[model samples]
Target: MRHVIALDVGGTAMKAALTGLDGTPLYEERRGTGRERGPEAVVESVLRFAEDLSVLGRERLGTAAEAVGLAVPGIVDAGRGVAVHAVNLGWREVPLRELLGRRLGGVPVALGHDVRAGGLAEGRLGAGRGTGRFLYVSLGTGIAGAIGIDGAVEAGSHGRAGEIGHVVVRPGGPACGCGGRGCLETLASADAVGRAWSAASGDPDADAADCAGAVESGDPVALRVWQEAVDALADGLVAAVTVLDPRVVILGGGLAEAGDTLLAPLRAAVAERLTFQRLPALVPAALGDAAGCLGAGLLARDLLAALAVRT
Candidate 1:
């Protein structure tokens, strides 16, 4: 049976899976990124984990994997197989493709931005499957989005297209990690909601979980903060919908865990903003974090097969 090795490297952990040709995931594992230790250490850790996975696949699946697909958080130059930059991972201009290819013994390898892979998964097999255009927004510790058109994730010319978090909504509202002020992410991300609620409610150290709990218990401050987040998200979505006219806008990441609390108000706010424009269906992402890995596996499978034919 043909198999592929898939990995999604996040700021916190690197999750890997061995998937069959039919998309059945046979195994999964993860390890801390240890970014504080530097990029070289992280790369070595990833290589060791992949090597172990390759060995296990041969033993358990009775065959070696054909290729490996790896996704990371950053600006991935997919065509060139390089990681231009990943601020969260502290990597810059990493030759990720060549390194992985050598580690995996020349098997075809694919490197992609983490969220782009997730967007691809949504476009191909999940909520946005039938939609020709999709805007996938993820509100996590940080916020970002991806644009998928014609069943493919559009990775812009410079590989920095879907960086919707940097969209300036409030002008000088709040400072962002990207050294900017008043970004949509500073207002609508889960972390932002939590911090906003915490400050307004006199709980200086409250986390996102606390904010969610407070919202459920009908705390006035939490409700206000959550509402504000919804409003900001709605505004951002309005602009995105106007631009792309996507059939569906898929939400993923930590904030999405709020489910109805996040989607219900968001949907209402989005509805109120639309005029004659086609109202896009707002939905939660089905695959979650696994979306990237699954999409990576699919990409690896296709790429390796094509490369084999070319050779």
Candidate 2:
């Protein structure tokens, strides 16, 4: 059976799968990215990984991949087939699609931002399925978002449309990696919450999970930290809703793993802030960590179909 190679490349690891055009998985694998070795090494690792998957596909299915889809974290210029930048992976202006295509023996390849691709999968196949308009927010080490319209995720004019994390929630507040002060990510990201809780609890190693546990135990300091993060997140979401008017908001990532501990207060806070804006349904992501892999498969299948139509 014909299949495609789907790769979701992260800062620390790569998750890959071989899937049929209909999105049925035939094989899956995981490997460390070796990012500690530097960006060039990481790029070589990705190329090598793609080659390995291609050989495995041919050996198992009697044919190589028809196409390949790659999801990478960074400022991606999908139109140019380049990963503009990713701080964690130290990638900058990497022509990932072209490089992967060459490595895969010229199989057509599609490249996309990881978060946006995950949102695409969620909107079409997971939590946001059938929702006319959706916003998929990932609150992990850093925060990012994908704007889903109909069955697709919109990349926007500059491919930076759903960057809700940089929305300034507090003027002159915490510094953010984006060179902005008081950005939503500075306050609401899992890393940010962990930092705050660590300082308050004097644990030094306290993370968002620990903060959630403390809140469950009715720890006053931990509850304060969690609520602050929730409030900041709600502030950002309100601004997003005021502009995008999405029908649903799907929250995912490490912080979201707290479940209702995070959602209930966020919902209430967002509700209190809204005046004329329509309230969007808040839900957790359905695919967990597998969303990116599934999304890469979807990207490859869609790209192949489009190419066939054009030819």
Candidate 3:
């Protein structure tokens, strides 16, 4: 079977698949990124993982992968195929595309920002499909965003186009890892909600899911925390909507797993904030965690298409 290797490298784990030309998964697997062991180890693990998948594809399907796609977090220089900086992974200016290409015997490779890759899948195959213009926001350990136009996600001139997380919603609020104060992620990310709930509920282990349950059960403290996060998200989103004017906004990531608990209030909050800007339809991402992996497959397929055109 003709297939491509697709990998989504997350902060903690890597999701990989041998994907068919039509985007169906022929084989799927997961492995820890081993970031705790250090960035070098993580890079080795990723290479080994991809090499293993390629071998597996050859053994099981009687063919080698034609291309590879990698989606990673933090700043990316896609044109250069380098992962510029990922604070979570503690790496700098890694030429992942070149490294992977060598590892895979010079197969073509496409490197992209993880969130942008996910948004690409959303725009073409998930919630934002057929929307023409949309924004994808992920509220996970930290927030990030991707702006989708037509069927593709914009990487900006510097590959930092849709960074809604760093938008300061509250002046002089919590400090952000991006070296900014009061960034939206500081107040509205899943990690932020979990920390606030942990403090309020007096349980150091309480997280955003626990907070959502408490809100459903009518816990006043949880309600307050949820509302605060929602309000901050609304502020940041309004700022984005004002400038971009997307036709739709797709929300994803861990915090979005709370579903309507996060969406209901968030919709109201954003609606209340908007005045002159057109209200874009807010929706949940349809592909869930699989979006990034599927998107990587799409990237590989796109690379193959471009190569064929050149030939």
Task: Single out the weakest 10-residue window by summed lDDT for candidate 2.
Answer: 97-106
After superposition, candidate 3 runs with Cα above 4 Å error: none
Q: Whole-model Cα lDDT per candidate?
A: 0.86, 0.94, 0.96
lDDT of 1 at 24: 87
The estimated TM-scores of all candidates read 0.94, 0.99, 0.98
Rank all candidate structures by their lDDT, best first, as comma-separated numbers. Answer: 3, 2, 1
Q: What is the lDDT of candidate 1?
A: 0.86
Q: Write the per-residue lDDT of candidate 2 for residues 8-111, one digit (tens) a residue.
A: 99989999999999999999999999999999999999999999999999999999899999999979999999999999999889999999998877999999
* lDDT tens digits, residue span 127-168, model 1: 899889889998988788889998888889988888888888
Better of 1 and 2 by TM-score: 2
Q: Which residue pairs in model 1 clash with each other?
A: none
User: Model 1, residue 262: displacement in angstroms?
Assistant: 1.1
Best by TM-score: 2
For all candidates, the clash counts are: 0, 0, 0
Model 2 CA lDDT for position 133: 97
Distance (Å) between predicted and true CA of 309, model 3?
Answer: 1.5
